[model samples]
Structures are given as structure tokens and as C-alpha cells.
Target: MTQALRFRLATPQDAVAIIACVRAVRGEHYPIRLLYAPEELAQAIAYARLVFALALLPSTGEVAGLAALEPSPYGRTGEMGVMMVLPTHRRRHVADDLRLLLVAWARQHGRRGLWGEVLAPVADSPDAACVSQRFTENAQLVPSGIALGLWPGPGGERQSFVRYARPLPAKASSKACRLPTRHRALVSEILGRLNCPVSFTADSPASGAGILDAKHEEGLRSWVLAVPRIGSDSAAELAGAIRRIQTHPDVAYAHLELPLAQPGASALCELAEARGFFFSTVTAEPFHDGPGLRLQWLAQPIEPNGLLLLNPLARRIAGHQSREQERVRPWAVAAAA
Candidate 1:
């Protein structure tokens, strides 16, 4: 950025300044609630749960811009976000400096990648544009998935947040994955791109009942329904869960995850697709119980060319998902007509 600023990790003492910085743009609308609570923000910094890269005016000691990374409890990846550069600091590369600092920190922590959602640089503002996508792309991150109808946006509209990721340098993820016949090609392509090694065997049906780990993001009204271990009963239970979530007025999205190495995963994939889920992402670990596949269902239709997918592969994946969503949810088309 400008030679006027210096960059460093923010200490707990800087919590109040961070809140002031956020409030200047979002007031009470910032989704990161902790940023508004000085005590909680300070605690997060102290505990290292919220790692912030701060830029300051070297001469005045004023906070100029900030970026932060929240490590996933699942490990291997961290969500990098809360990117804010004051209007005064926009063009000077302060954001670029903060982003690079976070990426370096993530590497030091043994993270495989940095992940974030496409959102306006200023939180809770009416203009939910694609500028966030361009910003992440500027940081060397590419569109890895689309989180359709992820959160409530301005005008009571659901936000379709695109997922972005930057893969750090690492060796192959030696994962043994059982390929679902219908999704083999897509999964293979994703794995190849990630330099992941996959070994497949004859598909065998799961003998026991499946186990599901369900989590709801309260702020965003999004649900992550992961079937780490799939069994004969997974489809039935998962279908019930999906149906329940879909009917909730507040629920906007459901992310269905199935392990690639699980035999019953393929059947569950078919079942979920039948329920209108479409491809979103393929992960190896820390992102999910990976190497696995992620599918998503949204309450709203994604407009044509809605997501600004930055890379060729990401665009191809989005196009395939668009077609697949229609194929799976033909009833939706009929109902609309």
C-alpha cells in the first residue's frame, strides 16, 4: 500500500480500533457480531481464533485497513475475510498488503487453502455486487464453489455467495475415494486440479445406519448437512432433514456433503440430486470429511451468469451445476410454468 502505513498482526489492545473501523461502514449491520463487542473481539485475538492483519498509519498509529482469517475447527483450511479498506485507503494496495499477510499466516499454520465467500467489501450494504469476487481473484484465489441463496441480503432477498479458495503449495492429498458412477468425471477433474491422489474400489453398500453432522450458521441461515459415514439409512434420514430445512422460512440454503470413499455415498448423491441438490464443491480435507463431494440446494434460482466465476474450470463447474439443477428439479420448472 502507501508508504504511510505499516502492517502487522493485531493484538488484543487493538480490538476497539477494529470495531470502530467496522462500524464506520456497517454500523450494526456487520454479520461479524464479535467485531462490535470489544471484549469478545479482544478474546478472539488473544485466543488466536480470529487472526487479523492490520494496517496502520505509521506516523499516527491509526488503523487504516484490516483482513482476518478464521481457522476451521475441522482443520486444514481457514476462512479469510472481514476485508475492509477505508474509502481513503482503497487504491493504495492496503487491501492487497493485508491479504498477503493473512495468506502467509495461513501457510505458517499448515493450512492447505484460504476460503471466503463473495460479498460486498462493506457489509450489509444494499449493493451486493461482484466486486468481492474480483478482490479475491486479485489475491490469487479462484472460485471454488457457489453458495446459492446463502444469506438474507438487502430488500429481503437471499444472497448467492460464491465460494473462493487459494490453494497453498502442498503435496498431493493421498485420499482413497470411492467414485460415484454419475459424478466420477467431475470429481476426477477436481481431484486432478488439487493434485489429489485417489484410489477406488468396487462400490459396496453400507451395512450400518449413516451418521450425520449437522450445523446451522445462524447469521447466514445456511445449513451444512454432512454425511461423513454413509449407510443404507442415510438417504432416508438425510431426505427428512433436507425437507425440514427447506420448509423453514428462514432457511435459504442446504449444503449436502458425502464422502467419496463411502460406498452408499453414490446412492445418496442420486437421492439428494432427486431432491434438487446440485454440485457446489469437491474437497479433500479440513473443508469437509474429505476427500468428498458437496452439493447445494437454494430457495432462489441463480440468475443467468449470476456468479462471476473467475477461472475457466470454475465457470465450467458452474455451468454444469446450472444444467444439473434443472435436470434434478424438473418439477420446479413445471410448477413455475
Candidate 2:
């Protein structure tokens, strides 16, 4: 029996089905926990700010898959979240269809880009090869970082994530943002290779800039630092923030998001690199409209050589990370001493 698939924006009525789908995919090896409760999900859907899409069988209205464009904290980007297809629907192009639907929704909503993170297998594993091939078609995947203890297995397991981005076509009047001098070479290299448009603006740093917000996720042992602007005093502010983050018990990773348009961005980025931060991804501006650089610092060691990198850009970033870590190791050790 052939069934027609219908894709539509989810309403509050679809919350139960969406939650069920999420729980079903999670099963025994739940890689991540759902951040929203069913009631919360329903409320959020009713609010109509974040867009969730449901793939259903028209005959019985059975939800076959689900995807969502979650609003970023900074309001300029939408993260592709809760992408799942039923086990029975696997390898049937449902995922691709869902991805397209999500992208279209993001574009309709004026998102600069759509970002997603996929769990990848370890290097040399048979599953790694298969998964790599799966992402090879029409996906720009970048190797992110080792998410320690992110998955559940026999005891527990960690998974490496591959981050991918898809930029939407901007308005004709939108001007390109300036690329920082220190990161220009690498960023240019990345832009040259990827099919995404990442524009930056070079402008004077906003006055009285400092850390605007910070959030810590206990589950991931990660801290996200948001900086509205990076000015001359950013170094002192960031140093204090990093010191606090490092001192946090069981902290594994810290991420900083800074506006790419701000003046002194390159200088601040250089300072961050000296303090062990490395480029992770380019995301939409958090505070205003533009692109921002997402940099990460890991307190724990990462075995990049053991990661399964499907994209060339991912591999290059991983290599750069390894080299940067090595270059900063001695300084970190001596500083601690």
C-alpha cells in the first residue's frame, strides 16, 4: 500500500505526536535529552515564533517524521533541531525531504542560515564509512568537537559531532560583513571551499562592550558565553569569564560567540586563541543581524585523529585544532605551574 506524505507546520495539536517521535528515536541509546516538555512544546508551538514541521501520512495522519527550526538566543539564526524519521522510514529519502522542508521554513522566516549537528561514528569503523557516505551528498559538514560522554552505550559513550551550515539567499541590498585580518586567511579558505555565503562587516567596536550573557548546561558540562560586542576591554572580561568557566567543577567545554562586524574582533579572537580557544563554526549573529564566529575551548583533551570526518573542511579544521592545542599546551602547563 502506498501512502502520501504531507508536510506542514506543526500546531499545538501535534505536540503529543512530536514528543512521541522524539522519544521513539531516542529509545535505549539516547544521545541527547529533549529540552522541552510536551506541555512546553505545545505552548511554544502556540506562540508561533519557532517553527516546527511534521511529516505525516495523509490517510491516518500518522507522524512519520519531525523537524524544527529553533530560534537562536541572538535571534538571527535558526538551528535545525529534532530531525527524526521513524525506524521503518529509514533510508527512504524522508530525511532529505524533511531537511528541504526545514530549510524552506527557515528561509520563509528570514533566518540567515540553518545550522545542524549530527553525531558521527569513530574513525575506521564500518559505520563511520557508511555515515560519511550518507552525508556526502549535498551537505557541507564540518567536524566540530568531541562531545565527551554525550551518548549512552554499554556504560556510556562520547560522540564526535559534525556541524553543517546552509546559508539562505540574502536580500540584494545586504552588504557583506568584513572578515577579521587574523582569521581572514582561514575564513577565506573556508568560504572558498564551502558553498555557503558568510559575510562579515568591519566596523568600529561598540562602546562599553562586555559579556552580555552566559549560560551553563549541566547535562553537557558546557558553557556558552555571548558577547554583544568586543572592544579593547574584552580581553580582561574574557579572561575573567574563562577563569570562572575553568574553575567550574566538571566543566568540559566553553563556547564564545562574538559579533563578526565588531572592530577589534580579530584582536579579541587572537587573545582567545592564545587562551586555547579554537574556531568551531560560523554562526548567525547572536545580538543583531550579521554573522558571528563560534569558538570553543576544551578543558579535556580531544582525540581528533580518532574522529570520523566526512568533509574536507572538517578534516582541515580538526587538523588545525590539533596543531593549535599542541602549540598552546606548553603555555597552559606553565601558566598552571
Candidate 3:
């Protein structure tokens, strides 16, 4: 008998069911680690910044799938995670239905876009294909040398992730921001593909009190740093933070998010580059206050040729990433020498 599928916000009672669904679907490729414990799941359900949803088989009263939408560093952007569907329901399009439900929820909440990072060993992997069919590929993130303990692959190997985005129905006006002169053209092209407007501003010294927050994801061996403010001493503060980040024994990748609204943003970006960070993308507002820019520094190498990009812009960005790496190779070599 065909069972009717229903979707709704997940409650505390649904935590166990959601965990089971995740284990059933992802256990083989990426075993459930500490991230989705019942307590954590419950908290995620109750967290104001996160939306958790479950797909239920009404007739059988079984939770067939689960997904969550968590606020991004960008205020108008949300990241979709905890996406899982049971093996028995694989052919039922339960994943798609859950995603659509999540998208609707995000739109109702005034989100400009939604994105997801999926474990894609190859471009055509089933997981990557699903993301391509549902979302536009934004960029590929290389693994930060350290194993992602939470997302273990076959034989428990860590897998790199690919970023995909789905923009909702929201109009974004053209806005000017400072960008690196060397890669301005490529960055402009990427922003155009994303329907974002850009006007480069002249670089200026960052002044004011900048706040820096750092969180280490032990499961991913990754460090995420958020700078919500830029002050006169911001450059020194940022440099200190990066130095500390480099000292972490297990660090794989470090991400720095800077607000675009900051007058000294362009200059700060230049400072970051000198410290080995590379341009990633311009995210929406970092906070409820305004938009932001994202940059990354990798402690190891990433093979770009293996990326499966579904969008032309994504491909272009990948190409640029390769070129940028080459452009920086000499400097890196000299610094090492």
C-alpha cells in the first residue's frame, strides 16, 4: 500500500526518529558522529535561529526523512543541513519534498537564499547530482587537510564538500563594495551570476573596535572566525587571530567572515590576503545589520579538477581558484624558502 507523506516542523519528540532516519540514510557513507545526538537534536529543534523539519509517513506514522535550516553568517541567507531520507523511501522523492518544504519555510521567513554543503567525492555522485538538480552550485570547498570526523566516507575517509545555493524570490539592488583590483573582473562576473550588484570602493584604513569570535568544530577540525566589527586596531587583532589559528595542531581550514558594510573592508581584505587568505565569495549580510564578505585559508592542498560543478559560474569560480592558487604559488614558495 502507498503511504501518504506529510511534512511538519520537528518537535522534541521527533528527535529519536530523526536520528534513526539519519543513521539509516547516511550511516554507510558518513556515519552519524556526535553532532546529531538526541540532546543536540532537541536543542536544534528549539533553537530560535534553526528550523528543523521531518517528513512523516502518515499511514504508518513513521518519520521517513529529516532536514534543518540554520541561519548563515549572512542574515538573509540560511544553510540547509541534516538532510536525510530512509532507504525504503529512496524512490519516493521524500528528500525533494522535504527540501521544498524547507524552501517554503525560508521564503516565508524573508530569507533571500538557502545553501547546502554536501559531501561530493566526484561531481556526478548521487549526492552531488541531487544538489545540482535542486540547487545551483556556488563553489567547491577543499578539505582542510584534517579528517572531518563527522562526515566519514567509505573506509571512514574524510570527504571534501561542495557548496550549492538556491535563491528565493527576492530582489537585490546593485551596491558598491571594494574588491581586489587583480581579480575584480572575475569577482564581478561571479556576482553577476548571483544577481548581486557591486561597485568597488577605494581602500581605506580600518578603524573602530572590531569584534572577533572563534569557534572550533572538533568534528571537522575546522575553525570559523567571525569579525562583526572593524576598528582602528582591527588589522592587528585579525593578524593575531590568524596566528593563533595556525597554531592549532588539528586545524584543517580556517574561515574569516567580514562585513561588507565596514568602510575599511577592502583594506582588511588586503591584509587578510597578505596573511594567506583567499577570496571565496560575498555572502549576504553577516548579521541582521548588513551584508558581508567571506574568505578562506587552507592548511593543505585541494584538487579542483575533481569538482563536479553544475553551474557555469561555479565552473568559472573554480577556474579562478586554480589561477589564484597559481598566482600565489611563487609568494608561498618564497615565503617557505
Candidate 4:
């Protein structure tokens, strides 16, 4: 028997159904102990602001899945979230259709890159398997690398996560920067300012960035950046962060915010440039509960993929668009000394 399905953009009115679908899927595929409340869902929708939609079965007008695309300050980059299909709609190409639709929407908006995280089963059991393999395979995406272990919660206690990527067809004109492990200390310090609670510092030259886990070490989510000593608010602190980057032979990198509202932020950026660092890519908080800012370089370099979480959705979206090699915004290179 042939089946019929329909898809459309989701609105604020559909928030309840979207939440239900996500919660149901999480119960089976992920360990989301703290689910979002109704107000939280509203806030997430507000933050995402650009293409948020739900999949609907035309025959019955039932909500089948939820997907969204969000803006990243980085040029031509956007993040994908809430890609979920209801329990009843799994294994039916519903996700494939929704992902393709979201990609088309992103390409139309001039966004060439997309990113999302997939969870891996921490323990060897059928209960913790990664469920979105089919979505990545159908899109013909390439695995930039694995995230290894990134999960929320106490140190040594977080679950494992995976990073996936797909280069957009339209990004042929775009070039990404690649940095080595030596710059991890420098990048860590800059990103630390925007995302605290998880800070990094270089302990020894050979060790690179020595990740301090307030809890345990193994199995915890380690923040990998070129520079160390993130989250400083003083000139001396910034100086130290720069020194670390300068001394390290690795590529320099850091994620900085616009620095408009803060005091002395521009001065710090100025100091960074003098010390041989520049602006690379913009990175915002992963969730609504985090800070928003760009990852500025102090003395490190930029990664080849342009982001920590390589976006598979970006390429998938690029495949559905007609535009090829269109430029959006130029990379934020540091001013010359």
C-alpha cells in the first residue's frame, strides 16, 4: 500500500505538539532527564528565530516531527536543533523528508553550513544506541571526526556524544581554517569566557591544554581548544592568555563575542592582535541557558571545518538549493599589528 505525507513550517501555535514529539523521542533514544517545560519550549523557539517547522501528515494533519535552523554569528554557519520524529513515525522516511526540507530552507537563507550532535550509547547495550545514522547516510555526509565524550553533568560522569558533518555544495567558494593540537590552549581560554563552568588552561608545553575537571577526568566532556586560561577579565589575565598562545608553536585560536556591552573587551581584543591573534569564527552558547559570543583568537589558528561540531545538515541543505558558490559574510580576520 502506498502512503501519503505532507510537511510545513512549524509555528508558535504548534509548540505543544513539538515538545510532545521531542520528549517521546528522547525517552527512547537519549537520556534527557531534564526536559524543557512549556515556557522553555517557547524560549527556545524565540532564540532559534529563523526557520522552525514541524512535519505533518497531510492525510490526518498529525504532527510527525520537529526541526529548526538557527543563525550563528560565524559567516554562512547555522545550527540545527530539535530534529525529532514522533515514536509512531519512525523508520518511514519522515525524518529524511524533514531534514531535506530544513536544508532547502537554510540554503534559501544563504546559510551554507549546518551542525548537530548525535548521542552514542555510553555502555554496550541496545538501550543507548545512536538513532540518527540513517539521516546522515541518506544525506551523503562525511564524518569530520568524532566528539568522543561531550555530555552535560558532573565531570567523569557525562555521557558520550558524536560530531557529524556534510559540506554544503554552495560552500565550494568558501575556505575553512585548520589548526593543530598545539593551539588548543589558546583557543580554550577565549571560548572559556563565553562558556564557563567548563574552563581550560595549559599545564605543560607538551601537555597542551590541561583540562581541569572539578569532578572526575575520564568519561567527562573535555573542552579542546588551542589556547588555555579562558574567562579572564583583566589585562594581566589577557596578557597571560596571549603569552601562552605566543609561546606555543601550535596554531592560535580563540572564540570572542562582539564585546559591545562589556567594559575593556575591545582593549583585550586589541591586545590580542598585538600579540598575534585575530578573529576567527563566531560561536554562541549551545543552549538558551548559556552566554552568547564569538570565539576570538589570541595567538592560535582556526579549524579547517570552521567549527567544533561539523554540520552535516549544512551540506544536506546545500544539495537541495540551486545557488552555487555564493558568498555570505567574510571571515573575521584579526587586524594587522
Model 1 regions lying over 4 Å from their true place? 1-3, 11-14, 37-47, 57-62, 119-142, 151-156, 168-174, 199-202, 205-211, 227-237, 287-289, 304-310, 330-337
lDDT of 4 by residue, 1-337 (tens): 4346678876656667666676667653333321245565566566555466677767766667877776653345566655777776777877767878888877787665466656534334364253464556566544322332245433433333343444544312211212223333333332332222222222211212221111111222122222222233345545665454435443222333332113333444454445544333323232222222223332212122222222453222222110111110122222222
* Candidates arranged by lDDT, highest first: 1, 2, 3, 4
Q: Specify the highest-lDDT model's number.
A: 1
> Mind sharing the TM-score for model 4?
0.47
Which consecutive 10 residues in model 1 have the weakest lDDT in total?
119-128
Task: Give per-residue CA lDDT, model 2, range 1-337, as digits (tens).
Answer: 6576898878888887877777777653343433336776688788764577788989888788887777776656677766778888777888778878777776676665566776656776676454643564356443333332233334345555666655445323332655445455566455434343455555555456555578776656678887776656777888888778766667767788776766766666776777777666665444474557777777665666567766666667677666666766664444333
Per-residue lDDT value at 269 in model 1: 79
Task: Give the C-alpha lDDT of model 4.
Answer: 0.42
TM-scores for every candidate against the unseen true structure: 0.78, 0.79, 0.82, 0.47
**All models: lDDT?**
0.73, 0.64, 0.63, 0.42
Residue 171 CA error for candidate 4 (Å)? 6.3
Please report how far candidate 4 places residue 83 from its true position, in Å.
2.6
How do the candidates rank by TM-score, highest first?
A: 3, 2, 1, 4
Worst 10 residues of 3 by lDDT: 141-150
| 1-337 per-residue lDDT for model 3 (tens digits) | 6677788987767777777776677662343343358887677666645677788888776788877788764467787776777777777877777878888887787776566665445565666354543333233321111111224346644565555555324447766666668756765554454555466777667766878888777666678788777778888888888877766667766777887656777777777777666655555444555556667666664555466655455556666666665665554333333
Model 2: per-residue Cα lDDT at residue 166: 55
Query: Which digits, one per residue and each the tens of the lDDT, describe model 1 over residues 263-296?
Result: 7767787777777787877765554545767898
